[model samples]
Target: MLVDIHNHILPGLDDGPESLEEALLLAETAVANGITHVIATPHHRNRKYDNPALAVKLAAKSLNEELLKQSIPLHILCGQETYFYNEMLQDLDGNLMTLGESGKYLLLELPTNYFPAFIFDILLELQFSGYIPIIVHPERCEFLKRDRQLCYELVRRGALFQINASTLVGENGLTMQRFAKHLIKHNLVHFIASDAHHYKNRPFLIKSAYKYIQKKFSSQYVTYFMENAKHVLEGSVLQPIPPISFKKNSTKH
Candidate 1:
């Protein structure tokens, strides 16, 4: 059973599926893609969106009922894709934004082409607050493009990095694709999430992504992703896969 740690499947809320029908379709697609568990990571703490915690809970309950009614076995968990802001700590304290479904891992989304000077310090702040921060899609961050060393430094400071599955396939572009591949090959990537948005633009799927990782890398790494995700769900201790050293690029393209 594969667990999708990041996705926007919650219905009629945030930027994901505009309607409940689309939400159901995304959920169906998730099931068809061999995802037994999915976390509905609605954008929070950035879009100034309302706290859909109640709505998400209701959606999960209804979806479970309907799935059971149709005899389709799939579980949709609840989470939030929190954006980086100064008020992040306040939101966490207020319980307006949650981490992974189990509340053990916080998915922190950074700016597109800009990173604050205090980014590392903020991560340490989150850790000090007793919440594990999973830096979402660091490959897509402009800060990383300018200074790849920062990513390595982040990992050293007890921060986990998540690479987008589609980026690994070059869906975004060549640059991101190469960076995504580099992270995986170097063992810097700890999670591979869909970060899926709508159905057409960024569909909710994981099988191809899983296969890509398995074929390009070792099956053990795939299992490693699965094991770490499972540990997050079970609220167990999430350990890093030994320290990884970034490969020094020798060729000057």
Candidate 2:
């Protein structure tokens, strides 16, 4: 099954769909794009939105029921796209939701403009506490885009990277697309998710992105992402793919 590990499909939660109809429409689009499952990762602890675990679970359940009623053939699981904070451990202890609610993988978002100095320590702590942190949309982060070594270090230290499908297709811009491709070429990317928020502009791009990857890279690369998604949902160890080093000064436009 094609699973989207990151998305904002839950209605009235964050900046995703605003109503049930919009949510259903997004689900239809996702199903049409060959996505069978999506984790409704509403924003949590972000300055603008804060959806707690129990509340996101309830919303996901409601959306699932509506999908069943509408015969959408899509499943919504609970998750959170949490902004990194020192209190993440405490929040997890107090019932913060992990990706797919599996408790094995957590979807984390860093600031787009800069990387926090404390993130390394926080990632280490989370891993030590038994939760694998999956950094969301790193290609779009200006700091990481400027310094590929930061990404390598995070992945080297046991953190997984999730790239947005939109970035793969240059929807965000050419720079992000290049970085997304770089991450994939070097085996630094572990998951590819929609990060979809609406039915139109930020719609599900998994099918298109996978097609691009298959054509540009190889079928095995596509399978790599798919297997990683499966392992994430199963809370099992992912298949090993050796990462290659980024060549020096290779990110120039």
Candidate 3:
């Protein structure tokens, strides 16, 4: 079964669908695109949005009931795309919902354009606390885009990376598309999720993204990504893929 480890399909949560009707439309789009299960990762403590763990779980439960009532055939799992904050560890001590509520993988979103000076320390702390930090969309972070070797360093430090399907499919532009491919080729990316918000604009393009990967890379890589996402939902430990160093010539655009 195809599982999407990230998305904002929950209604009235964050910047996703505005109402239950819109959310149902998004779920239908997911099913048509071949996604059997998707984690409804609403924004958490991102300054503007504050979705607590229990709230997200309740939201997912309600959405699931509605899906069943309408026979959508798409399952919504509970999770959060928590923005990095200094007090995050304290907040997550018994709070923040991990992907699938499995208490293993946490979907972490860093600042859009830059990584905080103490970002590495935060990731290390999370690791010591028995939680694996999955960095969402590093390809779009301007800091990582400019200093691509940071991708290798982050993976080496035990942080897994998830690239958005939009980036892989070039919807976000060619620069992000190339960076996404670069991470995949160097074995730094662990998952491909649709950080999808709406059915019309930010749709789930996972099927097309996998097809692109199969054509440009190998079926092996595609399988690896899919399996990693499954592992997140199952709360299973993933054997890390040792990252390949980027040749000096390939480090920058």
Candidate 4:
């Protein structure tokens, strides 16, 4: 009943699995982890490669064909991990980098360092342009470490947050794990994704994380995150929650 909103399961396109075999392995791992659905989010803003709209559509088609051939029951959707650069606005405005699964939700990936001032301004611009921006892996972004309020403000400004399951499982780093816990405790996170690239380093861990959260938080919150993800798959707009401020030290609290 869970859906992974971010992943690199597409074969040979990005830094994900290099072959269909690997992709299938990762897909099975995701399914084993209770992920009923996953979004194939490839790198769209890599200048070395062109992730045009048509190209992504084609990749989705190809991936579907492979999945069908392998008979994997997990449903897969299409999306892009968009780089938050100045030119991203142009691509989005022109309809290239827009969200693929829900069509209204675009996944915005910030640089690992402190968020450039322009990243915030441009996210606002995208919202003004009528697109819901899903901030990918906000916990892993070093910018959040610099100023957690920036993250809370993003949620305040009506942006959605997607934390990777790896962060919660402590597969990333201690700081990221702390941030993920903080985000979840404050209810600042709306979705959790695999952001998974491999079956080993980043095996899908939703099942374990689900048990963890369900034990700590209410099952209804777990349902909220999982169901909200399904809403994305069905192309439904997520019901927005009024943003809450961060405690700055929710990790320790």
The per-model lDDT (C-alpha) reads 0.74, 0.88, 0.90, 0.77
What C-alpha lDDT does candidate 3 achieve relative to the native structure? 0.90
Q: Which window of ten consecutive residues has the lowest lDDT sum in model 4? A: 244-253
- When 3 and 4 are scored with TM-score, the better candidate is 3
Better of 1 and 4 by lDDT: 4
Runs in model 2 deviating more than 4 A are 247-250
TM-score of 2: 0.96
Writing each residue's lDDT as its tens digit, candidate 4 over 23-48 gives 88998998788777777888877565
Residues 163-215 of candidate 2: C-alpha lDDT, one tens digit per residue: 99998877988878888888887789999999999998789999999999999
Candidates 2 and 4: which is better by lDDT? 2
User: What lDDT, from 0 to 1, does candidate 4 have?
Assistant: 0.77
lDDT of 1 by residue, 172-191 (tens): 89888777777776667888
Better of 3 and 4 by lDDT: 3
How does each model score on TM-score?
Answer: 0.89, 0.96, 0.96, 0.90
| TM-score (C-alpha, index-matched) for candidate 3 | 0.96
The residue-level lDDT of candidate 1 at 200 comes to: 73
Residue pair clashes in candidate 1: none
